[model samples]
Target: MGLIKTVGLTKTYNGTNAVDGIDLSIKEGVCTALLGPNGAGKTTTLNMLTGLINATSGTISFDDRYMGDRRKYIGYLPQYPKFYGWMTGEEYIIFSGQLAGLTKKEALSRSDELLSLVGLSEDKKKRVSGYSGGMKQRLGIAQSLIHSPKLLILDEPVSALDPIGRREVLELMKTLKEKTSILFSTHVLHDAEEICEEIFIIKKGKLIIEGDLVELQRKYQKPTIYLNTEEPIEDWSTTIKQKEWLRHMDVKKNKITVTVEDMDMAREALLTDESLRKLKINSFEVAKTTLEDLFMEVTGK
Candidate 1:
């Protein structure tokens, strides 16, 4: 059995269902992503699972045991984690540890280990106000792990960062996954693809799809190619549609989108076209459908 499972897990607000009946299984030591668009009830589901709210109906089990103070085994980082700017990173983590029922000595010792684990040991004495956005997120992770929980949950952990900061945090998550189970929520598909082994995608508060990443893409993705020229080709859409290998084409202001009878053959043909040589081709690339593509298809976005 998986480490965590929910049967008919549901939550209702007034008369409406925020999260409908969901049967979920989260395996130990695997990273899971709860993916969904805006208003998808992802946050609400996490809240219920974390015991921040009451479930109107259903049950959640951890390690195949009926629920009983399961919160102690879970570490959560909300989408916006608030911290005291006046405290040093080290002080805050130790403080959190104490609040979680650790003795002062245990908290201090654990805080030291976690600070190193989250790459904050060097800056442990720095006040929270001096940290960068990425550094602060790392600190949040350190605090969450202070008690050595078995499952760690993060909500859109990197959604607010710039590209460089996002990459660094994602790398940190990769290392953390080796020691604890992780279930994070995000609308950004690439983040899930980069770190998670399994995906749980939801739409409108309901589960849409859940499976291995490679299997999901292989089963549902379409073959397509994209083309670019040095300059906008005059009447390019009409000419491109006339190709025998083309199934369909969507020409935008700068690029041409082509679905074809054969992805490899069409891409090669486009690249070798003698007519296009005179026009100075910039890029001719085949694009595989990604989790992002599947997300759009399932949600009709």
Candidate 2:
């Protein structure tokens, strides 16, 4: 069995189905990205998987045991966590470790180590009330790791951070991968493309696509050719239309963009076209589609 599995998971709120028959499997030792737009049921799904909210129907299993029986092995970071405002970061981590059933000595040692790991060792004694949002997030991550759980679930962990803070958190997450499997939910496509080994793209609470990065890129990458000519290429569109390999062509200023079925054929044609040589083409390049483009294409936004 995979480290985490949700089978036919469904959640409904006041007669509205928020999560509808979603199934997912996350293997151990890899980071998986749960991607969706707002109100896509990502939060609800995470809650159900963690047993914070019971699913309306379906089952979640971890390591062959049901979710309820596997709580000790899972560590969760909610979207907006609430911590005692007066408690220092170190104290809070100790409390979390104790709650997770660690002994006092173990809790203290783990708290210190985790605080340092998340880059909060210097501010370990600072009250949470004085902590910034990013700092609080780092604390939350440290708290979640206190017990050394097998699976870590982070809900929009880097969403509220600045670029530098986000980079720090991403690096921390990468560092933690050796000890824990991560299931991270976020609307940020670039983050997923950067760190996640596998991804599940959901729209309106339904699983639209799930796969490794390379396969997802291959499936959604748009076939487009870019050409820059010495002068304005108004006739280039009409000329490309005559070629059987060309699907469509668009001309903008001195550049002509073409879409074709096969990029190799398009590249060969562009390189070998004698007429284009005579016209003094300045540059010819193919534009590969990105994760952002794939998200927009799949979600139609």
Candidate 3:
């Protein structure tokens, strides 16, 4: 059973359905990603789930175990979080706790614990205005956890950061997944592949795919090999193009990527080919279809 489930969830604006009738099931105690290109209604779906907005025509159901106001069971961090520049990171968390109904003493205690969890304890005293992009994101995550909700939702958490900042937040998310159920939205396929167990892909406001990441990968996987040489291999690829085991081959500059019907036969043929032996191979790798490949195939991008 899902910790949270949506049935035909939808939202509309100006006679157009921004979020079409899409169903979702978010399992507990694991990381799940809502993936789509920009303007695919990812934010709208999340907003409805977090109670930030009402669904136009659908049901947002939490487990019966979590009764009363749904907001109490959810922690939400928006794509662009706003913070009081004048307040210190420590003070901001405490304030968020209070707003979430924590007593002053409880808020203070929770602030310390959460700040430590996000690795912002040392900089807790610093004003929010002085923090870097990554530091501020960590602070926002801490504030969200101040309430200790059952589910944590983050919208495009690392989308705006530099490489260094993106890495910092991604690593923090890896740690947080062990402690809580996380539902995060992102268009970056690599980040989702790194941390999520399940994924739901949306396109043009419609739910196109949803399943366990590993299972989906295996289901859509193709037998493929990547070869890069010190020199161009266009001529050599043409030589093997007629082989029955070779399904398709793509050559770009000094690299050749091939899809094969029989991996064992293709491997044997390529490894023993005299023409290939004469070339100085930079690298050769055997790989299955990746999430990015799957995404491109489904999204038609």
TM-score of 2: 0.84
TM-score of 3: 0.85
Candidate-wise lDDT, in order: 0.85, 0.87, 0.91
Per-residue lDDT tens digits for candidate 2, residues 73-183, read: 888999988999999999999998898889999999999899999999999999999998788888999998876788999999999889877988899898988779999
Report the C-alpha lDDT of model 3 over 1-301, residue by residue, as the tens digit: 6989999999999889999998999999999999999988999999999999999998989988999987888989999999999999999999998998899999999999999999999999999999999999999999888778889999999999999899999999999999889999998888899899999999988999999999988887888999999878988888998999988788998899898899999999988888897887888899875767779767765
After superposition, the stretches of candidate 2 with alpha carbons farther than 4 Å from their true spots are 65-68, 226-258, 264-285
lDDT of 3 at 117: 94
Predicted structure 3: lDDT? 0.91
- Residue 34 of model 2, lDDT score: 94
lDDT by residue (tens digit), candidate 1, 195-255 = 9999999887889899988788787666888778776755656766767788867777667
Candidate with the greatest TM-score versus the true structure: 3
Model 1 residue runs over 4 Å out of place are 65-67, 227-286
Residue 299 displacement (Å), model 1: 3.1
Give all TM-scores, in the order shown.
Answer: 0.83, 0.84, 0.85
C-alpha RMSD between model 1 and the true structure: 3.7
Better of 1 and 2 by lDDT: 2
Put the candidates in TM-score order, highest first. Answer: 3, 2, 1
